[model samples]
Target: MMWKTVLITIFAAGVLADDFSQITAVVTSQCTKNNAEDKVPEVEAALRTFGNCLKGLVDLNVLKTEIEEAKPNGALDEVFKKYCDKSAQLKGCISSVLQGVRPCVGNEYANHINDAQNSTNQLIDFVCYKDGDRIALFIAEGGPECFQQKTENLKTCFLNLKQSFPTVESANNLSLVEKCAKVDEMTSCIVKSLEECSTPTPANMAESLIKFMRKDSPCHTALPVSIV
Candidate 1:
């Protein structure tokens, strides 16, 4: 009778071990770079946490002979089923995040990046109010056409602070104006991305500010960006 209980317990534990091992491999197989190298140690750490949490019910050694004699029940089966179910879910979320580096996924991220760039440029126009060859703070707002021409080779950011800094800062507001013009543009881009995900609209260019994060959008799978 004791041998019968031991056999059942060993069988159950073996099945559980096999399922858990497969889940570990499924997670480790992802997150690689060009040479098939794992991205980082951090990825392993995260996978361990996920695997451990899922298999926390796995230790059956505590069951004595009488407890095991009852034979396999639905409860034991449910534990293995939960692992397969949750591993699938974790796989999907990881795939989505990794898509960011993929060509298709990169393109998707780029769309947001491009939208972010356009939105940033608009804020530059609103703030710099560049007109003709002359730039002044008090001038009227320019349309998209203001960005049509480059102040330098930089079409998106109106002024390059890297080159603009000079005798201007110690000299007067002109330097300050030049410095702020570029910095403010970066701020606009960040804010616009948040908006696009939340409040996107076709009627409004400012709607870039209301961006909707469409992971399943055709943009993610069809264009230059996609997950592997």
Candidate 2:
């Protein structure tokens, strides 16, 4: 009788261990990255914390027992069936982790990078106010030669402003801008992906973020400045 109870306890613990292994595997695969260059410190920290929590849930001793109890009669599957809610728990935990981490993520790119901030602001005003069109029209009334010069000046201004930052702060500020831009792009991609995943388990969410980031796409393309 005692032996029977011991065996049952081991098997039940093994089943739970299996579930934890599955959940942690998914979390680790999704959170781990190769290139640090494209990572934001806050996002990376969140990923690390989330991964560690998932890994901590795994029980190695029970996992070993599960390996020993492998039978051809599908006992493991039967045990797994008892924990129908495990998947749901994983999904809920993932949502909770993301919610906790979301507050840490911010538009550091636009906030910290003076050059990017100025460029973005200028672009917004130019597009919204049609400043370029008015300048082009004003210069065109003078002569074709004057209009051409105006167009050149507009292009130069756009390029110069996009590249400009305080000389004292350029080196450090540029690095921060690059990191923040990648983080912004990654956060945007992850948000879009989470919307698509009706049930975002740790694995599913991680997979989505990893898939998008692996593409290594550019953050933004330069807009053409038309003086004509």
Candidate 3:
């Protein structure tokens, strides 16, 4: 029993390290695209702090005593209020500051500031808060032990329809009617692909959902080069 416990602890640590690296890649990629590379260090620092708080919840080391007596949603809400709320507020404040400082930094630098702010807030809302909600739901449904089977059963299904797929009907150009038809086809393809995934959990569901959103979402207009 002692040897088994030690092995489980080592395995869990390895899995956690891999999971954290993947999450870091996703957030850093977004930061680079948004031209906010300088903010990466700060974002990482915040994540580390947040991770410590989360350790308590995940390992049940921090709330072990209280959680047994408390309701699932109630205990989770308490943790969120204590930890996540403060981090969210801090991220929001930093984003606001970046936006506010844009004009003073001159037009040449304004675009960078706007991108930085936009990406930061998006990360906070879409990644941090959304994942937090997922975790809360996981706890409500019986926590990490319950999710082990879910993670094993979950399948990530992706159907990539290139931009040219819709345009190809008109020799790399799409008519209004053709565009609408292609959009319908794309939607159907995605639905069919999802149907094939055997029992998806929240973590698996996000992979394709975010990709689809990014594919269809409008990009910000490129900033004009400033005349000297």
Candidate 4:
């Protein structure tokens, strides 16, 4: 959730180009494929309502300005502290919108929407309330630079890592051991990249990630030690 927020903040701050249009295209493709053509308009309207609700929650112009001004250091934490204070209200708004739209969307679409909402809630709770201190420390210790400069590298590494595993319809199909191994592989890839990029403090970055995986992730049951 913090990562999504960070990417949005960076884009708002003019650090990245408009790749969101491409993302929108992909989402549109999926929507058309998954939902009945007749229900597409209803789905679009539901998404619009959700967007409008978000607009009412926070001033995008103000948020963009703040992010732009905050810049290279502490921006992520500062933005989170300032804006994520309203995370509870945001979550409530999300739930309310989804409830209104669930009846109109297909079951498959509804399930995906609910899953997205749950993931958002989890990330919000993790970064804004549960592990704020750890997140702040991670950001302070070269997390931003590593993310900013090595985003494509990290993305490529993750994609390649995923390729190593057998393709499955759902992650639930993977056993706990298999999931833990994937998590370990992904962490190792990230840690390796941070070190390769000469991030200001790769160890701290790795430690934070290790702690997160061990304490918060599905792999928690299996991951008891630092992967780095």
Candidate 5:
């Protein structure tokens, strides 16, 4: 039984390592591309720091889950407070890496910051300290983990559309639209409306759509969406 436990632990460790490696690869690519062709040391520093914080994220996520399960009095307050604290820490670390890095690296850090912003709210809400926290977290983190899966599907659908797209009329017939049928348009409209509200009414929905329609380029600027 002891040996079996050890093997199980090892297997779990391996899976975690693999997951981290993949995330690292994505970040590294983003950084290296954005930054100049030369600066590698800075990228390494960013990865190490990101990895460290990722460790803390894992712990904090677990801790929050535990608190939620225990349902201690005023536990929600504590959970949210810790979330705010950790989120600030994550932003600072990510900012440090972004500084002096190239554009590719900048993009990487930007995405991480965006993700961090989202995660911050989530931990807080899991404790139910904030109103609308439950609904926000529900769409963002709950519901069969559909957001992640759908995002992946959207990317894939876009790629295929780019590759062997059918006629323009049927372009919207992609796979993502189907599986997310129960949720797609509503979600997209919510984000788009929020984007519009961020700027003046003489806004550019076309530009908004283009920001996504086009490849993620250095020239394009899009409004930030909160994830946490």
Candidate 6:
């Protein structure tokens, strides 16, 4: 989930950096500055533990190779399931880290961090828990085209959306309603890409993406019932 957040942040702004290192620096800096210097080592260690846990579960190079070598027509349900089974442990690790840092950083920072993590967790739940088989099948059938060919377009769409605002900071500060408006455009763009790529754009897939945006977001009531 931390990786998801870091990747999204990078893709949204169209910048790349060492994600774990950036996260550790940001968190450790917070602790050191807020009259919590003594807690710095503890917080740093906890963050490293969580990061190591994630790295153990997800090897980017291996995952990429597996996905690339996966036969389009072959069964990949089991392959994805193997990773999904570790979700519980991943969640537990993050939960513990969050709890350990809360007292040092206070509620505001902890809650902000939690919200970001929750967004990634929601995505995992959607892909692996709520509708695992359907999602796995979608990947098996359309993954190559979407990931290999259209990934740039997807990234471009987000970067463009981010550019529409005055500044990156301003974009990040947008109200939930304003953000959901942009999300609507993003959803349409994605659906269009899927159609152009000859990938199946199931109604539920679009619906789920919208619903996922609404979850834990202040835009729950502002977003439409259907957009696809």
lDDT of 2: 0.37
Instruction: For candidate 1, write residues 1-228 as lDDT tens digits.
Output: 112222222322333454556433433343331333344344334444434443563344643232234224423223333333344343443333323223221232334533433333443333332231111111112322333332233433323333443443432444434334444454344334333332222113332322223232333333322111
Cα lDDT tens digits for candidate 2, 198-221: 333422333443333323323333
Best by lDDT: 6
Candidate 3 has a TM-score of 0.32
* lDDT: worst 10-residue window of model 2: 219-228
List pairs with backbone clashes in candidate 4. Answer: none
Question: How well does candidate 1 score on lDDT at residue 82?
Answer: 35
Tell me the spans in candidate 1 whose CA falls farther than 4 Å from its real position: 1-38, 60-67, 72-228
lDDT of each: 0.33, 0.37, 0.44, 0.58, 0.40, 0.62
TM-score of predicted structure 5:
0.39
TM-score-best of 1 and 6: 6
Q: Ten-residue segment with the worst summed lDDT in candidate 3?
A: 219-228
Model 4 residue 93 distance off true place after TM-score fit, in angstroms: 4.0
**What overall lDDT, based on C-alpha atoms, would model 3 receive against the true structure?**
0.44
lDDT of each residue in 109-135, candidate 5, tens digit only: 444444333343343333333533332
Clashes of 6: 0
By how many angstroms RMSD does model 3 differ from the true structure?
13.8
* Backbone collision tally, model 1: 19
| Candidate 1 C-alpha RMSD relative to the actual structure | 25.4
| Candidate 2 ranges with C-alpha deviation above 4 Å | 1-60, 106-228
RMSD of every candidate to native, in Å, equals 25.4, 24.5, 13.8, 6.2, 13.7, 5.3
List TM-score per model, in order.
0.19, 0.24, 0.32, 0.62, 0.39, 0.67
